[model samples]
Target: MQSPQYLRNGEAPQQQQQRLPPHFHSTVSVQKLRRFNTLILVFRFASFCFCLSSSIFMFTNSRGSHFPNWKDFQAFRYVLAANAIVTLYSFAQMGISVWEILTGSTVLPETLQVWFDFGHDQIFAYMLLSANAAGTTIAWTLNGQDTCTASNAFCIQSYLSIAFGFAGFLFLGFCCLLSGFRVVCFIIYGFRFLVL
Candidate 1:
């Protein structure tokens, strides 16, 4: 005779279905990839904003300050102009990135193709940032001897500006590298998909 407990319940046996882990599920969405790309673009745009505002502040405030001398002022002007150019370039890059993500256009030709396209853009960014850092360092060193100025204040501000600018550029460069890596991976995965 069947067990009384099973008869009383009058239920069929339950079956357990297997599922992929959360991490596996997390990696399987095209929508999630688009969202991540958008987030990165937003972050880069924010960095550009910071660079623009800081460049403006440095240009305007340095003109009024007595420590930077006339030659230093000219250097700062160059730096300001470079920053503006880079900011505009960054905006253009962001626009293109956003469009690509929206259109689900991750696949590209040879990895060199994408690298050349994005590399030129990032090279300009790096040049501007490096020039800004070098100019500020020189200005600070030149102004450090002014006895009437507060102790080390000019030097500190200049150094801080250089540090922040370089850090930002480094982060931007890393992102560019990561983007190149992603392109390579896409190419490899695309080939595998075709083979399968």
Candidate 2:
């Protein structure tokens, strides 16, 4: 028989098993956390690839009449520059992530890293979004009534490049979310610590 001492807490063994403490943890297992971090690393790398490809696509196009390359339009230049910056940032972050996964060391304090990543991500996300909007808007405005015109290869290429830029923007959004989650977790833990 179960000891009477177990019931002194005022619950049966089965009942206690079913009821979690009010402050119970909801964290993922360590293995799962590693996998999640690796997954984010892969995703950020893919984002870097997309940004690089988009930059190449836009920069190489010379078919447009008015504008020979991405530099011709301030919006296109912005897109190219923003994507390049994001590409570099993603690469660096990927390295940090890999290092963290392997050795459990971070360049910054855990909370600071989370906040730093979140802030930089928000900034870059905004920049990428704005650049994408500007580039796509200008591309469409240049296209006018023509529906992806066959004659204007530059116009078509511009659209395609902008599409790639949009893809990069999507990946950046994912990075932002991951970093934002880290920041949120840090904030929650800070609050809990204060409470305790």
Evaluate model 2: give its TM-score: 0.75
Superposed model 1: Cα runs more than 4 Å off:
1-29, 63-74, 106-113, 147-164, 190-196
Top candidate on TM-score is: 2
Instruction: Give me the candidate number with maximum lDDT.
Output: 2
Model 1 quality (TM-score)? 0.61
Superposed model 2: Cα runs more than 4 Å off: 1-28, 63-67, 145-151, 190-196
Candidate 1 residue 84 C-alpha distance from true site, Å: 1.4
- Model 2 scores a C-alpha lDDT of 0.75
Each prediction's RMSD to truth: 11.9, 7.7
Which residue pairs collide in model 1, if any?
none
